[model samples]
Target: MTQHPMPDGRRPANQGPRAAARNRAALVAAARAIYAEHGLDAPLSAIARRAGVGQGVLYRHFPDRAAVATAVLEENVRQIEQAAAAPDADLASVLGVLTWHLTESAAFIGFLHADGEYRRSGALARGLALAERVKGALRGHLPAGHRLATADDLMLAVSMVSGAASGLTRAERERRVLAAWRLLGVEVGPLRPFDG
Candidate 1:
């Protein structure tokens, strides 16, 4: 079978999968940066420009803004999952990591909350699923007889932290995050450092 020319007029190094993955990663990174800088309403063209890829590549990787948002949320959830899985991570460490993530992700989360269309997107569903996993991990770390009643409760706590801390200084945001954790009956130990 003859291979088709790639979108940018370059021949595939090893078929399309590798290039597609790289393009998708670049698109996601661009989307994250653009959204963080300009909120969810930022134009898709901006993401394409930032990724150094054409609009075709961006559309191929993410069909719409919600899809882009979903990719970012999925990545955030993956990082939180990794933190939860760390051998030495305890409840406090987990919360600390989550706090950092939620704070950093406040803008994206706000956009998700505000965009009605995103509420019904598959990405949102996946995000909620990953969030449940996070809640399960937190439950595993809770003291015996202490448990969050539902994943919704965990999400609410996250929302509270993000909403309450928006535009605040890092120290203030950390303070709000710790306070939110305390309200959830989680022990707020030393805040953990996060690379993101």
Candidate 2:
């Protein structure tokens, strides 16, 4: 197999799969933060720089910026799903769980909007699937027959919460999210004023 050239004009060390995977994870995390701060338009070269690795390292891990975005989205989805799996919850409890996930998933939220050339929906579907799981969780908590009825509503609320997170300031974002939860009858924690 032909070895790819490193960005620094050197060859990569003969690292095995485990090391490569670790580096890829680091690069994905760095890319997520950069993308969140700078939006999708952030430069791949900058992502490489922030990762403390070379451009070639990023390219090796993510063939392009979209790939990095997708990986970030997938991570977000994984996290939300894991949170939704917290056992024993009512409708309010379920919404609170989702609220926490959305708060933590701010960076990956961008993937939910990538319907263009970036095409990161595969990664997004994982997160969307979590919403579906949350719907299921909510069903068990609600009164009989009310659980499934809220599926569409919950999904819509998740979408709105995600949208609110993007345009509003961090403080405004939290307020919007809290309001959304309260509207759904979820006993959300009090939100701090916007500091950022």
Candidate 3:
């Protein structure tokens, strides 16, 4: 049997198990872009359209909005971990990666922060684990007697940084994160301009 295009000339989504990974990756990428631009309230149809897959493909991979949102966050953590794996990677450089993500991933941050129950999200746990490792590096870089963030301090800082980014323009996020961090006693030096 041939897999034929529909009357509109668009082929149906491939149903092979091999295609599942491709389709799932596509859905997560599309969801990330759509949510970044229009937020978590963006229509599921838009993510399907953006991924060039059907709505069924999207729903098959992700049972709900939060599930997809969790995947996006997981992907973000994976990227951070990859960056931190570099030989020359240090606390300041990794902090730069975090700053960049906090500015760009406001939708995911907002969704995860909406309720205490979301702490159960696997992404959140992976994130905390990553934060733990990053802290070891951060503390090594600190001068003698300098403060390191406690777990509670980090949790609060994330909330405040995401609060600074929420509903803010990109430039505003760049501005306000500095203010938020300053409140936590870290002075961010000059940063290179973020490309739009």
Candidate 4:
């Protein structure tokens, strides 16, 4: 079948540099939700449908699956960076943000170890930097005498939450997060969705 761009010779909402950027952002956002719900293995076409864009548009913005996933990971890193930079941010605050991310981006983290175009991208580097920011905030609002004495402690706490959260629902992930915090003696009220 012969396809046409449009009667006006330009497609709807997918023309120009501004639309390209918007389409790229939409694709990335759609990829995040699709990946979180369906795992990182979800088809690229799924992301296109979720973004309300055609496969051609998705491919134009992201040359491959790794490119789209890398964009999502980059978005995550930026969000964490913003959360960590808040003036009143503390250990609990940082941990809360990480907790929210654990459920949403666990597969994205695995991309750090995967060999692909994503490896060449700087997304993994930003993710590692976010770790340092998290480690730095561990002492800000921890319980007295129950503080994490070293970076390993932070790793242990994060691992517990992330490990337990694998393949679980949002509420289940929240429960696991709370248990992990208590295991480390850092009583954060409850794991809630992080807006930052």
Candidate 5:
């Protein structure tokens, strides 16, 4: 078999910078899958294996499992923030974005709260910033001079709606979310079923 050289010229199949980034992204995605499967105790070696990279490459990309977890969380939050900031994003758009994001964010939040290591790493900071941006987008939808004063309030309302959806089935989640959006004054008639 032909030998693959590492970009650093030290290891075989040494991928270049772009390939390294792709590998790192694959590693992070693998980490997310492993965490979802094993509840955050998933092995780093397994992550490397899943990413098809050597242990040394995984280490070079992420110092440890904690780093991998943090990277995954940060990437998730960054995606949410970007979605929130997309052009022509109105109240309905923002609500849909956040609602979808929160559905997935619960997993990361569960992992973060359970692990002390992640708490000190500022992993949650990026999530908070994203949450604030989402809240601002929601607030912008409020009627002029309406009383949605703080991000906390918006977050709480979202949490309530999301949590309420948990008790019901998929169709119920959709129904309740639409009702909640209307209650929040979002004029979600066109966006009902939140199909958008």
Candidate 6:
């Protein structure tokens, strides 16, 4: 096969989409682990080393720390979408999944809360769009006479759960989340225990 050299002279351009995807996944996973352990300020070089990729590969996939962080958050949104689309998923189950995710992903959540970079990079807007998708997916599951009319209402419920459960245990957070659901007039059935 004829080789097309990259401008950086480190790797060939014919690495294939699969290899590129693998590298991107590795970088995102490494960023998640390192950010969880050392916070978002962890060096890009450290992330590249952990992913077993060169700095150039990591840079090619994610131009900066905020891009990496955004990718991580985007993955989270995709997962939430999957959960919402599950056959047996209802409003309660979807909310439970989101609660569990937020509970286990405290570091990422903290980064979203503290870093203005996400807003500047448009990640926050993308996240809000995903949130709207979740809300739309759950709308059909709302109980009769319940009033979750808009995505903003759903977002308010999420804020309540996240804010109320701060510093609480996983179980406590689930309880608070369930309570928030009830308070929002969404009459969800009993929730499974949060596995996180």
Which candidate gets the maximum lDDT versus the true structure? Answer: 1
Deviation in angstroms for 86 in model 4? 1.6
Residue-level lDDT tens digits of model 6 in 5-111: 66888656565888889889888878867765666788989989998888989888888878898787677666667766777877777666666666545456555
Model 3 misplaced regions, further than 4 Å: 1-18, 115-146, 149-155, 182-196
The Cα error of candidate 3 at residue 47, in Å, is 1.1
lDDT of 6 at 66: 80
Please list the residue runs of candidate 5 whose C-alpha ends up more than 4 Å from where it truly belongs after superposition: 1-14, 120-151, 158-196
Residue 172 error, candidate 6, Å:
8.6
Model 6 segments beyond 4 Å from truth? 1-15, 110-116, 146-151, 164-196
Ranking by TM-score: 4, 1, 3, 6, 2, 5
The models' CA-based lDDT, in order, is 0.69, 0.61, 0.66, 0.69, 0.61, 0.68
Q: Count clashing residue pairs in model 2.
A: 1
Q: Count of backbone clashes for each model?
A: 0, 1, 0, 0, 7, 0
* Cα lDDT tens digits for candidate 3, 20-121: 888888888888778878887789889988988888888888877667777776676566565556576555555556666676666766564465535555
**Model 4 weakest lDDT span, ten residues long:** 187-196
C-alpha-based local distance difference test score of model 1: 0.69
Better of 1 and 2 by lDDT: 1
Candidate 2, 27-66: lDDT as tens digits: 8768766765676778888877787778887888787766
Best by TM-score: 4
Q: 1 or 5, which is superior by lDDT? A: 1
- The residue ranges of model 1 lying beyond 4 angstroms of the native Cα positions read 1-15, 120-124, 145-156, 168-196
**Candidate 5 residue lDDT tens string, 28-126:** 878766665555667788888888888888889887666887687666655545554667656556566555534433345455345466667665675
Pairs clashing within candidate 4? none
Q: Candidate 6, overall lDDT?
A: 0.68
